[model samples]
Target chain A: MLTALELIGIAAFAASGALAAVRSRLDVFGVIVLALTTALGGGTIRDVLLDVTPPTALVTWPYLAVAGGTGLLVFLFHPTVAKLRRSVLVLDAVGLGLFVTGGTNTALALGAPPYAACLVGMTTGIGGGALRDVLLREIPLVLRREIYAVAALAGAVIVALGDHLGFPPEPVAVTGSVVIMGLRILALWRGWNAPTAPKLDGV
Target chain B: MLTALELIGIAAFAASGALAAVRSRLDVFGVIVLALTTALGGGTIRDVLLDVTPPTALVTWPYLAVAGGTGLLVFLFHPTVAKLRRSVLVLDAVGLGLFVTGGTNTALALGAPPYAACLVGMTTGIGGGALRDVLLREIPLVLRREIYAVAALAGAVIVALGDHLGFPPEPVAVTGSVVIMGLRILALWRGWNAPTAPKLDGV
Candidate 1:
């Protein structure tokens, strides 16, 4: 079940990356690179950090096929589908929730402590997006005023706390994911943001 | 001496990032972000992969200061500094050489295998710039034209081979660094570019 959600998230994220690449005026090659990175970059970092040999994505072809195929499809149909950008953002939110929860869950399964799992989850959720922004030369929305990673952190912490308190894994994950999605919507609606760059002062 | 050179390289790399940000027409904050990432992102990645506690630059004030401070200076002097953009490419090449050699030396010191160390060196040399390109939404030089990472790889391989043959560390490092710098310049001057983006029609 969780793996199913993760795959969905991957596809959504890849689509988002492809859309961004198109908006950035990239060629087909660039679109593919962006899609692959958005879909795989976070998990790749996590696996590399955990020393997961060969990486899960490299272990099979489906992951690559899904990300790449989805990206290509989106790239080809973007002009037709772009009007649905708002709907896509909602899908992006779902993916974000799943990714953050999945990341934290995977970390815990690997025997990381609650705090570490939560951190991993946060990284998982935002890592690919951050990489995407970096490639696009845009300020990462994570570091900017976006309530993006913060929401993931909050949800991960909740899920981790639930697990630590003996909650069943399934419930904890679902609860956490829901919390993340809800919070993201709230954040957007409320225009929540991190503190702006410290006011520049003449030293 | 190594520390001084590292600082200089960091400054130059940061300046290069800042200049790239200008070419992309980013705002002041964006410029600073690009500068810092260009100078320090690769090392940060290396530390994270190695699981080093605190990561060197974050632990040490000077390295952190150099990256960000250089960005600040470049941002303040954008107009004047932008005029030297062409010359900055020369400094960028020099910094790439220093970075690759430094990364290779550090990896070797950590007792990594020659092949892995060489890869580490190559990654460290190109990682920051690649990241900067990614952020700017430009095609990464590593993924596109320029013998950029190829130069680092060649230098890293040479140093590794020298080490295996019991060559003195200094000579190996010096020659290796020179090889990278020389190749980089030749590639830049002669328009050497790696193959990329094979046709998508078949697959």
Candidate 2:
């Protein structure tokens, strides 16, 4: 079940990347590269930080295959894929939840301090999309004005805190994932945004 | 002597990052973040890839101190720092050489394959600036037309090849550094650029 969820998250991230690349009018190769980066970049960074050699994303052929296949699918039918905006958003939420929980759990397992684990977990949820935005020459949405990172951080802290209190892993993971997804969905539905720096007149 | 060179490289990279942040009109925190990222981002990524636990950039207080101090300096006197364009470029080249050589040697010491070492070495030279540009919402120059990555790759390949041939480490490192810096300076002087993809007049 966990494996299935992970695969779904990876596919969703890959699709998101492909759509962005298509919107940017990148070539097919660029599409694939973006998809792979979005799907795997976060986990790779997390693994690197945790001192996991040969990151699972790098050594796992199946992960690459899934991302690649999703990219190809989107490339072939971008018009149709683009039409599924609502579904895409939902999938993105799922990915955010999965990555946050997974990243936090992994960091904890690796004996990272609670603070480091929370920061790393939040990054793992947002880093891939942030990187994609960077490649596409846009401000990362998470940094600009989204409840994204806040939601991820909340989820990560929940897991970290629960683990600290000696709670069972399964319930904490589920609750954390649900919280992130719920918050993300709620923010989207309400058109909510994190506050940006106030404008200083005549600056 | 080597330690001094490394510190100089760190300071130079930090200064470059700070200048860019100033140009981008980032506030104080953004300036500091960019400075730290540009000074140490490459090495951090390289270390991660090599499975070096607790990235040196994160663990070594002095590295952060040097980068932070340079950022503060640039923030206070950006006008003067900006005027030293030639000096800055030279410093950048020096940093590039040191990072490329350092990254390759470390990867080799960790028993990474020669090809991976070469790529990692080149990336260590360019990653920081590329990341800074990405944060600033600009396409990385190395990916566009700059001869930057080419020079780094050349230097890396030289080091990796020499190592493979059982050459002395000190000489190989010195030779690689000189070659990269020389190529970069020459390229700048000649206004040379790596070829861009041929224009599709009616895409």
Candidate 3:
């Protein structure tokens, strides 16, 4: 079940990355590169930080195949993909939720402290999109104006708390994921934005 | 000698990152964060890829101290630092050379293939700066039209070749570092630019 959800997340992120590449007018190769980066970049960073060498995504051929295939599909039919922006955004929220919960669990399994695990979970949830935006030469959307990181952090905290309170891992993970996805989707629908830093003069 | 050189490299990269953050008008905290990222990001990535657990930079307080100290110094005396742009550029080249050589040797020691070692070396040389540029919302200078990656790759290949032919490590490392630093400095002085892709129409 986890594997299936991970694959779906990878596909969603890949599509989003490919679309961004297309919008940037990148060639086919660039689109595929971005797709792979977006799908695998977060987990790769998380694994590395957790001292898991040869990151799981790199060793697992299925992840690569899924991400690359989705890139190609998006590139070949970008107009159709673009038309599904709303769906893609929804799917992206699902991906974020899964990544946050999974990342928190993975860190905990690796013996990371609760606070550190929460940070890692948040990083995993947002790392891919931040990387995609960076490569596209834009400020990361999460760093700019979104409830995105906050949503991820909230879910991560819940997962950490569940672990601390002796809750079953399975139900805890499900609840955490649901909360993240719901919050993200709600933020999108309601046009919610995170507050930006106030400007100061004469620094 | 290697440890001293690595410290110098870390300090140089930290200063460079801090300067960039100041130029971008980031706050003091931002300056420090960018400095730490630039000084350690490349080696951190390289270590993870090479499957080294608990990255050396994270474990060694000296690295953090040097990077953070440099950041604070730059933040406090940016004007003096900015006036030394030429010197900083030279120091940056030195850092790049050290990182490339160090990264390649580390990878090779870990039984990585020569080609992979070379790529990791180049990444170690350029990754920090790339992250800095991305955070500042600019295309990475290396990706744009610099001979930066080429110089690093050349140095790495030379080191790999030395290892393949069973040369003693010290002289080979020195020779590699000199070659990378020389190429980078010469490129800067001569305004050498890497070739860009030709324009293509209609995908």
Candidate 4:
């Protein structure tokens, strides 16, 4: 059941990446590469940081197939998919939640301290999109606007708190994921932004 | 010693990243983060792909110190250092050569196939700069201009061929490094670019 949720998140991210590639007017190879990076980049980072051998993304052939297939589909039918932008944003929030939960849990399982686990979790949530934006030659949305990374960090902190309090992992993970998705969706709906540095005068 | 050469490469890359950060006008924390990422990102990717546990960059505190100290120095003395752009470029080429050699040798030591080792080597050479560019919201130079990735790839292929021919690792690494630096410097002098995709009509 958990695996199913994770796979759904991966597929949603892959689809989002495909859409971004299409919007960027990239060729087929570029689309596929971007999709794979968006779907797998975060987990790859997490696994590497936590010293997980062979990184699950590389070992799991399904990830490549799914991401690549999604890219191909979007390349062929982007106009149709582009019409569902609202739905895609919602799905992306869900992916954010799922990845945050997974990353935090993985870090904790690997004996990372609470703060490190939270950071790793947030990184896992934002890493893929950042990589995608960078590849597309645009600023990362997480760094520029909205409450994205903040939401991920909040969710990760909750998981860390639960661990510190000796709560069961499953319930903690569920709560964290729900909170992350909810906060992100609410931010999207409300047009919220994290506080940026004040503009310097005459710089 | 090989270790000393690698340290010099790390310091050079860290300095370059610091200079970039200073130019971007990032905050102190951001400068440090970018510098460390630029110094360590490539090796981390290489290690992850090769399943090298607890990546050397993470385990080695000196890497962090060197990168962080460089960031601080550049933050304070950016104007002075910026005048040495030519020197920095030369140092960067040397760093690229060293990293490619080190990465290829590490992969071979870990029993990777020659082709895989070559890819890993090239990745290690370019990954740091790519990460730095991405964080700064620029397209990776490797993907767009010059013969940078090509030089690294050529060097990696040489390393791989040497492995296949049962050549000694030390001499192979030295040869690859020299070739990479020479090619890169020549490309810079000649103002060469990798063949770009032809301009599309009316798009």
What Cα-based lDDT does every candidate model obtain?
0.76, 0.82, 0.84, 0.80
Better of 1 and 2 by DockQ: 2
lDDT of 1 by residue, B51-149 (tens): 653345444567767887888788788788877765566677777888888788788888899888888888888888888877766677778654886
Best by DockQ: 2
Quick one: ranking by TM-score, best first? Answer: 4, 3, 2, 1
| Reference-based lDDT, residue A76, model 4 | 86
lDDT tens string, model 4, A1-203? 87778887887788788888877888988888888899899998888788886889889988778777877887788888887776778888889999998899888888777766876787788889888988787756664443676689789999999999999999999999999999978876665343534342100
When summed lDDT is taken over every stretch of 10 residues in candidate 1 chain B, the lowest stretch is: B194-203
Regions of model 1 farther than 4 Å from truth: A191-203, B1-44, B47-109, B113-203
Cα deviation at B82, candidate 3, in Å, is: 1.6
For all candidates, the clash counts are 9, 0, 0, 0
TM-score of chain A of each: 0.89, 0.92, 0.93, 0.91
Residue range A1-203, candidate 3, lDDT tens digits: 87798899899999989999999999999999999999999998888788777899899999999999999999999999988987888888889999999999998888776766876787788889889988887766664434676688789999999999999888899899999999988977675343534231000
Off by over 4 Å in 3: A1-44, A48-105, A111-122, A141-203, B144-146, B191-203
lDDT of 1 by residue, A78-152 (tens): 987587765666667778888888788887887776665776677678778788877787766664533575678
Cα lDDT, model 4, residue A111: 77
Pick out the ten consecutive residues of candidate 2 chain A with the lowest summed lDDT.
A194-203
List the lowest-lDDT window of 10 residues for candidate 4 chain B: B194-203
- Complex DockQ, candidate 1: 0.10
Runs of candidate 2 with Cα error greater than 4 angstroms are A27-30, A51-53, A58-62, A134-139, A186-203, B1-36, B58-127, B137-203
